[model samples]
Target: MPRFMGFVRMVEGGGMPPQALFDAMDKYIGEQAQAGHFLDGGGLFGTEDAVNFVVRKGETTRVDGPYAEAKEVVGGWALLQYDTLEEAIAGQQEFAELHAKYWPECEMVATLRQVSDEAPEAASA
Candidate 1:
């Protein structure tokens, strides 16, 4: 089975979902885990706790958030294993629908990216 990553982004200025909605999400995630669709997942703290780093030439610059230009931030992520890209996308759609149904007022986005099977090789001498 191929693996896919589902990236969950929260719109700027949107607060966390209510406890009832959070519980519903937890239940949905548990169902997916029990069905083997979910591999691993977790939510992240607000972007105010994040740090940004940029490397140019040989110099590395570190900047602390709140990021000025960021309109949205990753709020959570999930790793899913499926037989095909379409299946992965369908799964993501279902998850997004749950959010739409439960947190209608919240603005969120979910994106799916297929995971590569290739492993990195060591540098050649």
Candidate 2:
């Protein structure tokens, strides 16, 4: 089976409670796990977990925080294993549908990338 990186971008909504969001994600994790579709996943806080860097005069500056100014940022993501890209896409669509049911105003963007040999390895067995 081919593995895919599903980059899930959460919609911007400061009013949403983090706990509620996490609870929803937990449901997805549970459902996917039962289906054997979930390999790994995690949710992240905002720029607090991000790192920023700059290079000048052969010197580099490392800053801690979010790097992008976009209104939408990746709140979390999951890796999925499937037989083909179409299957991955279909899985993502199902996820989106489920999310919509809970968060009617929330929107998510899922981008699928085929895993390459050069990709980082999973730390767990």
Clashes of each: 0, 0
Question: Which 10 consecutive residues of model 2 have the lowest summed lDDT?
Answer: 12-21
Instruction: Give the per-residue lDDT digits (tens) of candidate 2, residues 1-125.
Output: 88878786865444564465557777877987887889997766787567868898889999876555667777777888887789888988877766666666676776778787586888994
- Model 2, residue 40: what's the lDDT? 92
TM-score of 2: 0.72
Against the true structure, candidate 1 reaches a TM-score of 0.88
- lDDT, candidate 1, 87-120, per-residue tens: 8888899899988888899888999998888998
Give the Å error, residue 92, model 2. 0.6
lDDT of each: 0.87, 0.74
